[model samples]
Target: MITTNRPTGPVRAVEILLAGARMQVLLVRSHPLIPVVTVVQPVVFFLVVTARHPATADRADLLFAVLLTSLWGGTLWTAGGILRRDMADGTLGRNLVSASDPRLVVIGKCLGSCLLVLALLACTGGTIAVVTGIHVPLAALPWLVAGLVFVALSGTALGYLLSALFVLVRHPVQLTSALVFPVYILGGLLIPTSALPAPLAALARGISLYWAQRLLSSAVSGDGATLPALLVLGALTIAYFLVGNVFFVRVVHRARVKGTIDLG
Candidate 1:
């Protein structure tokens, strides 16, 4: 039987988180499809977009859009089913019975995924730059850096929420795939929200990615106030975490009472 005597302290928590992050990074490295999804696919998309819209090839905003799309894809494939991976590997039960909060492990895994995606983003950026000779103004660098930071944070939060929610669904892979294009459209990652119908555009505003795209656009253009978009993105991220926490608590309780971590 698993014991609930695991050490409880800030140090212990940090250790667990670091361990989880390491494990996640290893898993991502081992997974063949993950690299393709996070890097190659985005590069291919960038190529196609530049080919079709040669006029926009030099625009930094185009690069930002591709990066945001890639980040969303990474969030779906890497962090979306994190708990399911733990359950399949027979660690979820142990984590549940441990005294330390399992959510910390999840958070660490998400952070690890974000780090991996960031590395992949750099590769994607390099490839795109080489292929298209697109150049970003030095003046926009600070804004771009800030936008990237928020993108990572928002993606991590969304991944955490999805990881918790996906555990409740019987077919998480199906759900994950189904989620891809809708968010692309709704988040305005590829197309401007202005092109979307008014009602759809209004609904898209509820998604953090919508605001994230707005921030990135401003970042690339070096125009418009980024504060409003940043504030909305931050608010939506916090909301996702709060709701996800509630779901995680309920799911963990149910798992404990039922004596099974395979809630799906």
Candidate 2:
């Protein structure tokens, strides 16, 4: 009976992440409808929203913000769903006791899910651009890409956190569905964060989504504080990842003691 809490080294970590990516590939191959569910639905939602309120320079920031929301929302669903599915399918118990850190299980899910989310975001943005002719200059593409990557990292960390949390619930998939819009609504995914009530706004700042939206929105608007925004985004990403790992560690410990890894 080995009871240990040692850090997972870089090599092992990468292996775990790659394993998660491979798992995702198998999932996509098995379920051809994943792309439709993750990508097309968001694009449709974007189209509907834009129709209701078109983008102009005054509110053009919403364009990328909404795209970020699509990826963010997708990450939440995919990560939580994957984790819950693994639990139900009996894989989580094996991984929890295997060589990998239990946290890596969540991290792996996030990495694979983020890849899909990126593709989904790109599809949504490209489709919107084709019809609306809203284009970012070539020079801006790098900045835009960086902003999107930052958002993805933050979102991935968020998904990892949710993966840890949703494991404790009966209907974990609904957990993500419940949070998808509400977090955005409060995080200023469509509107500015300042419009939120003071307490809500403060709470928003603590979450990675708020920082991600702020950074991406700044990049979209060409306000040119992207370096600082990137810094903040990185900080928030690290914070979320660390906090999520802590939560996962606690849950894993509890599950091991109670022998409920498969039960959840």
Candidate 3:
């Protein structure tokens, strides 16, 4: 009998996700600081913000809002970090040259980031709820989880996009933390994009995190425009993934043509 390859689709996707999940887990094990910061950073920031203002009694609740962005921040750096780490360790080029889809591999890595986000969210959310009495509606809990997952997918797409960009540059200053931090601030995670200057707010809407944060806020508060938020989040998630995929493909192709991937 002749050997044959199985068809790839959902099976492949699940496999990639599992692989990505494991990779994310291993990284957390290797570097314990990530989860610690994921759980602690927002609370710390919230404290600093509240100490000065003091009128935002609902600040704890608002601080909880940062979890989604925190998750994406983790995903952003982790996805790129994984790729860059692989490149540094001499595995990225080999994997890129392999027959398996590198996009899927990258997606899988992002899935790993999502797993960490889930854990951190649980710990941080639960702790804050117990300590501050601000809690998500029991009914709306599922929506919040869904919102986080969607945002993670979007962030992963962005991470993959940045990783591709990382290969194009030759120096650390050439990187885009400039845009990353601003996106985190303006993405309506740190503050409502509406609170930002109008022109800057409009620019922030270009990122999926804005919609994701809006959906999460609605889910947690059981108020606001849930339907519109969900619709926009879904659309933005798809757009981010597709755009990232195309960009990664093009960047990798260029790097290969230019013999630059090995330099990563």
Candidate 4:
């Protein structure tokens, strides 16, 4: 008699995620500065701005929001950076040639990024809350954790899309960073939308981070807007993931066609 082993859906997903984790570690370990820089840069800025505006009691709160947004942005940036570096160094092409699904590779790297984001959030959020006295209740824990996880997944999807684009353009850092930073600003992280110019405020309302921030605020404040904000965030995360996956698949195909996908 012969025996065979089978995997369930969740298990398969876990395997894929592990693959992504390994890829992220292997590709990015040499450049630990990315997260280190991310951890420090925002703290310094937050300190400086809060010191100058002592009247803003919410400064630390707003700064925490901004850092949260940057967690997603930084995850995307890290994924794209690793993809670009791998492509340039011929690592991605070689990996693609393996029997493993490119999607698995993508998923694994994203898992790694998600871990980083979670760690950063815990460390940074704890520090700010302690220093600034931003009280988060256990009642808000569910929504807060859910929102962060969704944000991380969305960030991972966005990273895959940007990574594909970076491969195509070969120079996307400035363009991607420019496109991403405003999302944080609009997310009510730095300043409230009411404070932004009319057009910019409108654009901010259109972003997923806007909903995410609202959800987080509601969770923290136990406000009436929590449900609606959660609904919007859920929808946005699904949409972004779908669109990003489609874009990544297309770009991978294009890369294969151009013969730019072979190992160097």
The whole-model lDDT of each prediction reads: 0.79, 0.70, 0.69, 0.69
Candidate 1 lands at a TM-score of: 0.89
TM-score-superior candidate, 1 or 2:
1
| Per-residue alpha-carbon lDDT of candidate 1 for residues 76-132, written as tens digits (9 for 90 to 100) | 889888888888888888777777788988988887897788778867786776776
RMSD of each: 3.8, 4.7, 2.6, 2.7
By summed lDDT, which 10 consecutive residues of candidate 1 come out lowest? 56-65
Candidate 2 residue-wise lDDT at 10? 92
Off by over 4 Å in 3: 2-8, 57-61, 172-176
Alpha carbon lDDT of residue 136, candidate 3? 60
Highest TM-score, which number? 1
The reply for model 1, stretches above 4 Å from the true place, is 1-12
Give per-residue CA lDDT, model 4, range 1-264, as digits (tens): 997686757786688778778768666656665565366755766676677777875553566566666665666567766567676677777666666677667756865765675566568767877888777889989987887776666666666666666666645777776766676666666667899888888886556777777777777778779889878777877776677677667666766776655334
Query: Candidate 2: how large is its RMSD?
Result: 4.7
lDDT of 3: 0.69
In the range 1-264, model 3's lDDT, one tens digit per residue, is 997697588887788778867876786655665855576776776566567667765654466556665766666566666666777878877677777877878777766766676577768867866786665668997887777667666766776776666666676334645555777777776677677898888887677767776777777777767778888878877877777777678767865787656635
If the candidates were sorted by their lDDT against the true structure, best first, what order would they fall in?
A: 1, 2, 3, 4
- Pairs in steric clash, model 2: none
Score every model by TM-score.
0.89, 0.83, 0.87, 0.85
